[model samples]
Target: MDSQKRLARTAGMYYLIVAVLGAFAHIVRAQVYVPGDAAASADNVVAKASLVNHSFVADLVQATFLVFVVMTLYRLLHHAGKNVARAMVIFVVIAVAIICLNMIHQLGALLVATDPAYAAAFGVQGSEALVLLLLDLQHFGYLVAQIFFGLWLFPLGLLAIRSGMFPRLLARLLMVASAGYLLDVLLQFLTPELADAVNPVLVTLFSVAEGSMLFYLLIRGVRTLRPAEQAVLAA
Candidate 1:
């Protein structure tokens, strides 16, 4: 297939995979965790998670999907007639780098758990004394990337909103998603734990935004980002 057709095929699926991952991570866990009197005990949480079968393949799939999704979004921006290729490229590069760093940090933390004796001999630990100190370079990278992503979404939302090319509903949704991300950033400083506890909600809002935008971009081919409007959204 030609590049355009290939791009068209991928445009919609990327956001859907994001939603699926969210459901698996949140909804599935919620089901397994139960609630109230019948809730799984703290001890049982690990056991129940274990029963679900920890598959490295799942992680690989998610990582691969995100990479492709980034690539697809780059192309989608091109299709939107916005001169955003360089910005999108930078976004993808940072995203991949941070995610890779996160995977490594997670692995390092795991090694400490599975081999405490060996880890101690090697001077490794599952967790450091301070949570802030414990945050690896990747965690910080992820946070910075999220801020960038939120910033990026504003231009995207404005493009959708002004162009009249997309459904106003989807455009509104994207704006809302952009707001949710900014909210996450603000909430992070005031209360990290609370922000994290409600992270799924924030992410869900973002997904609704991206999912709506991606769907319209695919089916309707909205080319709304006029030269002036692009700058406003880009801001």
Candidate 2:
């Protein structure tokens, strides 16, 4: 395969890995997590320990794959705009760091939910409460990461626009998705009631936005530029 084709396949594989594992983890989490019900959430975790373990493992592996996705995307786009590519890497790296660090909270919650010692120390009720608290930390920390998640998209979208290898609509949609992400996080933090009402719509839009680009990369690879365009990209 040529460089573009090789890079596309690598990125496509990583994207697939991240998406599949991420969806799996999220589905498991949603199945077990009872919003605003600490006792119920804890009970669910304890009852479905194996499933929760799967979720955690999937999340960790997905995150690891995402590092490759970012690196590959950087290599693909850096020729179009170096500074923008660097910004994209920086934002994604920050987001990844936050995500990896936040997993400890999830792990802590799991330990508290499963260990008899924790119950002995804090009592069953207190232990459950602690588990809930830790889980909440993980959730909110995810929101914090979303800030960088949105930031990375801006530069990525800009690069896509300049590269002339992607559809202009794709670039526009990415920027729109970035706004959606920032808006979702802001409302979720500042006006949670409103966020609850509207977040699903925003999430769907964001998914579609990213999904479009993902499918394009997988199916089309990067467009082969003409000599003039290549010169511009190199410059």
Candidate 3:
């Protein structure tokens, strides 16, 4: 009904879209990627070329919508802390840039998997290896982008906590989620065996934290600022 509520809902809507599409793309990739078996992975990709294409499109769309999510949140939260809001936007921008560039690896994988010219030039075995390599690059590139993804949440949590318009508990959960993301990335890169053991818990934490924020923004919106709180923020 009011401008703040409208903006909150808009941000929630965009966030929801980005989440769904990103999940879809990830699911598709997981289905096709065979971990270490390049031939099997290539076969899977070739068999599901259409699905892979759709996933690529989903990833691009997700990246685009992610920008909207952060920008809308920035507009709504900027009054809480101008520098933190700007930092959130900057982090998202960097993440989005990495995501867009990362898509090239996905495209390369698809091309190497499906196009006859690649097979003819490189031989089937070689082409398949290239596909696997490209997909590997794409996966690691996403993790690199995720570093900023987690960093953005820290500033977002700070803004939410400072705003006096959202629950402090939820804001704190977001900060915890930020730490979870960073830790997940660290474990994934440094100690993958340990990461495999720990990642499920981290994923659950991230989901709970982000899911709570998404639902609150969509359903309850932000609470109205009290006159006293507004005066303090203005000062």
Candidate 4:
């Protein structure tokens, strides 16, 4: 139980780091990216180059720490169901890989916006257009990664429920949040207009679910298992 508490706290700390950095990166992107306005987007990127760079670095760091978050979680939760825990880890790993690769598009956008060579080669308007295209690709790539992000939560929620460590309500909320993420991605790709309309609701759902889990882990950790529960887990 002591060890479990330690693991839970560690996972919470790592998750907090990932969440904060990820939010910062997203906020920066939202602030700088102007949809359908390539010239304006390029100008924003150039004007906020330092912030953009910092956001890029934040993303990389978030991705790196996400692995730590999941590995610790796997350790803490694997006793519930090894296969489920493994699935969760695999999903996070895939998401991390996709995120790292997606950053190349971000880097390309930055380079195109700031590098004089790109203007010389493609002209200013062309360079700006290329920047927009790369940013668009980066946006889509993030959605691709989000698919796995949502998937991992299913296994995690199941494990939490089975383990009897977390509140069942919280576990269910995580599963619902997982579905919400998938729905958000689908709507964004399939019916973008509707996606924009409901995005706030989806974001709120995610915040409530993930925030609850994080705070619980940080503040409450896992419940101590009874002897029978321990035996069952051993079995």
Candidate 5:
């Protein structure tokens, strides 16, 4: 295949990886976490240690692959606008760093759940609370990372619009989705009660915006590149 197609496929592969792993992580967490019940959450984790371990590993893998996804996107979109592309990469890098760091809390939760030392020190109930607290930190850390996630999208959407390689409407919707991301993050931090209220709508928009881009890359690749661009890819 040609450069654009190759890049598209590669990106799609990584995106799908990230999506699958991320979904699995959420699924495992959901299986164990009772939202507000620490004791129940701990019991679930202890009982399903394998699932919790899998979730942490999945998260780490997803975060690592996300960096490659950002790099490939930057390579594809930089020609459209160097500054915006650079900004996009920067935001994604920061977000990835935050996400990777957040995984430590997941590890901490696992340790608190499984380690005998923690059990001895805190006792069962206290250990469960600590695990829940660590997981909560991971959740909040993700919210903070979402700020950079949203920032990256603005430039990505802008580049998509300007590049002429993608549908204009898709690009426009991406910007709208970016707004949703920003709004969601703000609500999460500023008015957490309101965050849950708007989460479904925002998540829907995000899924549409991102899913469209992913499908486009996987199915259509990009519009045929100019000769010079094709030459660069060949090199």
Candidate 6:
């Protein structure tokens, strides 16, 4: 019971983290980022839309994001055992892979931005080829990460819902949240034109998924603690 409470507390902390990060991103987007883009050139637009500065905010937020993902999946992989930690380490591996991919793409974009020869060739006049390239990489990278996060959470949501470890409603909420994320991503892919428009509804619904799950964790987490069951499975 105590263990469950502790986990719930941690889950609450994660909610705070996500909420704070999202809020701060919104503030910056409103004041500085969007205004700067309006004045930027069309050629520079793609690069600006590449999400260079936006990516940095996301980078900071995601630094510890994987930790929560790993924590939630740990119980599932080990079923609660001494090896739970081992299972969680797989997430760490995923994080490293993502970081590596981002680094490589960022570097490639950098080369594009700085190489005046390449810039001239592409007819990229306003935005540095390197800057736009990097932004492009960052934008795509963000989308990829979102896909992974949604899919990753899907199973976790199912697990909690099916385990009968918490209230049925909690599970339902998770399922709904998962669906929202999936839908949001699919919508983004369908509308290539709106990809950079930053529509308010899209952003709003996209975040509901996270908020729903966080609510469940903070509220019903006490009922979901299954360390003994987890230990048996881990064995």
Clash pairs detected, candidate 4? none
| 1 against 2, candidate with superior lDDT | 2
By TM-score, the best candidate is 4
lDDT of each: 0.53, 0.87, 0.93, 0.94, 0.87, 0.52
Clashing pairs in 2: none
Measured over all alpha carbons after superposition, the RMSD of each candidate to the real structure, in angstroms, is 7.2, 1.6, 1.2, 1.1, 3.4, 6.4
Summing lDDT over every window of 10 consecutive residues in candidate 4, give the lowest-scoring window. 225-234
Candidate with the greatest lDDT versus the true structure: 4
Model 6, range 72-146, lDDT digits (tens) per residue?
445433343334345335535464356546645544544555456666776665435345445456555645655
CA lDDT, candidate 4, residue 195: 100
TM-score of each: 0.61, 0.95, 0.97, 0.97, 0.92, 0.60
For model 3, what is the error of residue 179's alpha carbon versus the real structure, in angstroms, after optimal superposition? Answer: 1.1
- Residues 1-235 of candidate 4 have per-residue lDDT tens digits of 8989999999999999999999999999998788899999999999999999999999999999999999999999997889999999999999999999999998999999999999999999999999999999999999999999999999999999999899999999999999999999999999999999999999999999999999899988898878997788778
lDDT by residue (1-235, candidate 1, tens digit) is 2454456457557655754653464443343333232213222333443432232234435556766766765664554546554465565556555555554433442333344464366443212321112223434545665665665566555554544446677767766776787778777768888998989998788877786666665665544446776666555
Q: How many backbone clashes does candidate 2 have?
A: 0
Best-first order by TM-score: 4, 3, 2, 5, 1, 6
Candidate 5 lDDT tens digits, 93-201? 9999999999898888888988989989988889989989988888889989988988888898899877767788888888898889889988988998999999998
Error of 5 at 3 (Å): 1.6
Better of 2 and 3 by lDDT: 3
The alpha-carbon lDDT assigned to residue 231 of candidate 5 equals 69
Candidate 1 — which residues are off by over 4 angstroms? Answer: 1-6, 22-60, 79-81, 119-141, 159-165, 193-204, 214-235
Backbone Cα, N, C clashes tallied per candidate: 1, 0, 0, 0, 0, 5
